[model samples]
Target: MKIFNRVAAAIAAVACLSVGGAIAQSQAPLVVGSTLSLTGPLSATAMTHKLVGEIYVDQLNARGGLLGRKVEWLVKDDQSKPDLARTLYEQLITSDKVDLLIGPYGTGTILSAMGVAQRYNKVIVNHTLGIPSLSKYEMAFPSWSLGSDPGNTVPNTVFDAVAASPKPPKTVAIVTSKFPSIHFMSLGAREVAKKRGLQEVLFLEWDFGNRDFGPIAARIKDAKPDMIWVGDIALEGNMLLDAMKKIDYVPPIHFHTYPAPGPMSKSPDGNLALSMSIFEEHAPFTNNKVATDFIQIYHERTTKANMPDIAVEVQAAASYAAWQILEAGVRGANSFDDKAIAAWIRKNRVNTIYGQVRFDGPGNFGDDMMKVKQVQNGKWQMVWPTQFAAPGAKLQVR
Candidate 1:
């Protein structure tokens, strides 16, 4: 009986120490602050951004932390409101007094926080803001296949893919939103279609928040377009796909500029949708140790937490890549000073899971910013710009 009691006490002590260790890590003093839409329409995306940020923080902590101090991450909910995002940035800068700042998840939120960032002289590494308009600001650094590049390249990529097919598509139709970014993408697609000598069988621009895609999809099917392109984000893409399914209008080729999480992620009938975006599973790492290690770590951590999907999110890859950029700057400069880190980043080629990148003066990748990926046989493959494609990655149009 005494031996049994001793064993129980020893087990209790071990459990207590494990819990205490986690608490101590959570209480670390080096705070990194950012705003996110944690409780609104964009909450799912925000969760992914937060998960990747936490993963990087955990990895850094495991390495004995940055500059001899543990990192604490503070993310305040912006509720997907631009006004709230501005207010949150003000609070993060003045009240929270975060040692570093990273850009939030959307173009509007990042744009709203710019004034605060400028006033406080904070250097922000943009994780998700893709609007080309935002590229003018020197303080915000965009990471991902860039929101701007897709508007131009998505159409060209789709055309190139179809043109290469055994049965080339000669007619194209486009359904897009009037939202500036998406609209611009539609115009770019139109231009690419013209350049490729494909007849414009149908073209429609729906107002923002116009939810019914049935009418548009029906018209596109009636037109019998050889290829169809949808220039909206993920939610609209899913709606369009569902509408198309109801009408039994599956085009030989379909493309989306935003690469939303639905229809394009995985389909039971062998994923056929093509999208232009940065994906973790398909990113061009080229045997780089830093990127491969980051990918492996992300998978291991997310799997252990029972949230493996987060590791596959494009935002997750980009958010962690932002941390990698900042981490390199912090360690290279050996200081937490934002200005010094920014200066170091401007001059140095930071290695990240995304690839080696050196920011142009305006915080955009000077070259090779985005890729064309297709979901073939339930796996995402980089199928464009042959130089950056993964091994065994090939394009197949069904």
Candidate 2:
């Protein structure tokens, strides 16, 4: 009789534990919070990040979510304002009590998000953070993979590609926005151009949100450099190209820092433009089933959303990879504890659409995996390196 009673007690305890675990799993969804420039100058690029985040969250929930709990993405708009981003991040962490954080788009905004995440000791996975030197937080991981010194390495890559061109530019025009990251990289490019012995005939900077590019375009035309590096973000590239077209100036070669992908391809003046790319919808990049499926879904959804560009390019890939990093950290740690998740990410490599990514370097950065892409026909195609180039596509210069 005594033995029977002890056995029964043991069974009851096991049952209670099982029920408790089930209840916890079935409770409210695990919330992931972030901000985007949803309705401001950055909106053109932010839309891609927004769509990618939506797709990732939906897919995560479909897969039973993180830690067997349904996931909810709570995204707020920062209106392309860094100050507002800082405030919103605070609200997301404190008021909403989000379980996890994904970084907002743009360098300044991501920096703001990082500050809040650090204060709360929460882990953050970010994509498209251009200025790595500013990423001093230990909990912040970067998925953009532009290396430790992108300002230096990225310009070297650009210069190397142009040097290999049939008609390398003897003179260069460097124009940039006063936006934080763009300005930083442009300054680096200026030094790089001088080091490479390319004469710098023109250098200009404009306020970030300035709508008028007519004066800048006129100045660029007067310089008449062989190649022009336009440090543009969002719709700035299109605006500058329009201004140049109005003045009957056609640049022999133009490189944009980060342009609105869809609008650029659609612009008459934007044909043959070059830019940095981490991934594009192509054979080598889509060779795996995961990337191929993502491309297809992005196509269907972006079309439904009426996005200007419905193709999976660098911005889309980087955003998707950010979610991948966050998910991998969560699953590897098997806990929502921010410290545990950050530790796991620092210790492990996450295979993403941009290839295997690790966050153990300075500023939680990894290898530089960026490629040079050109607008060919109506598509952005990788063309710099021999292997990653789109089918039968190589650098075209005249």
By lDDT, who's the top model here?
Answer: 2
Per-model lDDT:
0.73, 0.92
Clashes of 2: 0
Give the clash count for each candidate.
1, 0
Per-residue lDDT tens digits of candidate 1, residues 1-398?
99999999999999999999987865557888898877765565676677778878998999988888888889999997788999999999888889888888866788777768888888888776655655665655666645346555667766776676667888888889765566777898898788879899999988755779899878988999887888776357767777888887777888776644433565543266777655546435535666666677767776776652533545666788888888888899898888888778777887666666777634455444566667766666667666655577766666
Per-candidate TM vs. native?
0.83, 0.94
Supply the TM-score for candidate 1: 0.83
TM-score of 2: 0.94
Residue 170's C-alpha lDDT in candidate 2?
A: 93
Leading candidate by TM-score: 2
